[model samples]
Target: MVELNVLVADLRAESAEIDALVGGLSADDWATPTPAAGWTVAHQVAHLAWTDRQALLAINDEAAFRAELAAITVPPERMDELVDAAAAEGAAQPPAELLAGWRRGRDDLAEILERAPDDTKLPWYGPPMSAASMVTARLMETWAHGYDIADALGVLREPTARLRHVAHIAVRTRDFAYLVRGEQPPAEQFRVELTGPDGEVWTWGPADADQRVTGPALDLCLLATQRINRADTALVTAGPDADAWLDIAQAFAGPPGDGRDAGSRERERRTPA
Candidate 1:
């Protein structure tokens, strides 16, 4: 298992990368819509800032966090409305203000996590997570949302080794993915073998398992996060369970996402002006 400090460092790095992307954007750029329907670049950063604050509350003040949770009176089905409401509220701030708030919140969360006990468990919308696990989750979100912002700007970010964290979480959350969708995961274990950015192979599960997923690590991470449609990825799967999981795979918490259309990006690229 990776140590807490190492994960913390990676989280900081991931946040910094996204920070650099938005730090100098013009006000108009902030209003540009991202791939996530109805969300602008401002909405992406605002959501990150808002979520960072929630993490801080969970880590530093349990009672306050519980109170905040209790204040939410929305029905379970409409929880997404609450999330969108928060993002919209935050996105309304001036671009400079939004950027500053995001920087502060993410930095504070990282500092607190660094000092937290190794066995510390933090309350989250999903299951309680260890400090390390929490940092990993944050890194995954930072990268995924960052992708949305980049896509909106027509910028292509080079894949890096940091993607390993995203891939690991996607694999570990396989069961959660199914559970959130009101289905039981297959009992049998499936092997996952992915080629990383630098050609390193990351593997999980029994090698001889009948169910297997094999592909580039970047594609798997993008697929798991629902950033790229499965049809646009190079992932190859064997066995019925493996094939099915790819269709519905999601690494993040909350409602099942309406993933990107298979050829939407391609169509966008090929359309005549």
Candidate 2:
């Protein structure tokens, strides 16, 4: 398990970075659509705020969380519709109000996570997760949504060591990815090797594992977030399960995501434009 303090620190930094990104945006900017199809910047921030509130509920009142979960009427096939409705309702507020709401929710979550017991299991939308895993999930969602916001606003966020947290979750969730797809996970663990932002090498799985993935940490994080299509990344996979895992790698807990379309640039290269 990752040190909870380190994970919380990273989550704080990630939250701060996102705050800075949206802190000065105009109403028009907040309304701008991001790379996520049909989701504007406000929608992304609103979703984060809503989830933070949900996390708070789960921590403070598990019975309430269970009740909330049980009230869901949308079937699995319409999950995106459920998300769209939630985002729209949440984003209906003024831009300043939205930002403030998100900030308050984020701070509340950070404070709770800081004091949570290391081994405590918290019920989430998916399976129960440890406090550290909960914080990491928050970090991954923040970073992923932050990426969408940055891209929409034409800002380039420098890759940070924080990506290691996202990468770690991505690797840890490999089995979840398989489970969500209703496929049996490989009984064997495949090696994951990534070059971190500072050029430090991060390795998971056994050193002598026959299956392996090698790539830049940023690419791995993006792939895990589904921000980039697996077909477009520079990652190299050298095993049967490794290749399949890359195609469906999702760190977020949910139904299998609709992965990104291979960008127009990739499509153009394959055709004469």
Candidate 3:
């Protein structure tokens, strides 16, 4: 098992950075098109805020929390108008307001984490989550939504070093593989090696195990989080479960997202060989 304290600290730091990067963005950049189909940069940010609000409810009020989920699962026909409204509401506020609220939300989350005693049962996507899993999910969201905004703005955002939380999530999503294929990992360990930003690298599990995945952290995170596809991306997976695992990698809460369309690869070609 991974260390909970280290994972949470990494999440908090990355979340702070994501807040700073987005805070400095131009208005037009925030409204640009993202890898998320039909979602603008504002929509991506709003989704992060919206997800945080849900996680807050999970830790605070269970009844209120479960009831509130319909809002996310149900696809609204008026998504464009709703996103426009959220952006208008968020953008209209002064930069200080956005920063203050974002900071408050992150702080509140961190506080909840601090209060957990490692034995605490937290609400999670599949089954109850340890406090560490919850924090990892938070970090994954920070990296993911940050990228949507960064890519849309035509600037680079590097969360490669901050991706152990996400890489952890990906490796643990083995059950999703059972859903895709009928079998699961054969009672053996797997290894994951990711090359992070600025020469930093992250490796998880044991090498020379039943399964191993190695790649640039950016591409691995993108593939594991379902933000990109295996066919076009540069990630390499070796072992019995690799191909099946890659077919349906999910690292977040809620229903499986369609992600990038299969036949029509958009960002992969432009991502360099």
TM-scores of the candidates are 0.95, 0.94, 0.76
Per-residue accuracy of model 1 over 1-273 as CA lDDT, tens digit each: 888888889999988878878888999999999989999999999999999999999988998998888898986657889899999999999999999999999999999998889878898876789998999999999999998887888777777888999999999989988998889999999999999989999999999999999999989899999999999989999999999999988898888888998874453353221
- Error (Å) of candidate 1 at residue 209 is 0.5
Steric clash count of candidate 1: 0
**Cα lDDT listed for each candidate:** 0.90, 0.88, 0.68
Better of 1 and 2 by TM-score: 1
- Model 1 residue runs over 4 Å out of place are 264-273
| Backbone clashes in model 3 | 0
lDDT of 3 by residue, 1-273 (tens): 667777778878887766766777776766677877767766666666655765788888977776654455435433435545565566555555665676777788788886789798876445787788788888887887776666666556544456666776777775654554445645666677777766666787786676877787777677766776677667777886765566777765444566765542354334321
Between candidates 1 and 3, the lDDT winner: 1
The better candidate by TM-score, 1 or 3, is: 1
The RMSD (Cα, Å) of candidate 3 is: 4.9
RMSD of each: 2.7, 3.9, 4.9
By summed lDDT, the worst window of 10 consecutive residues in model 2 runs over 264-273
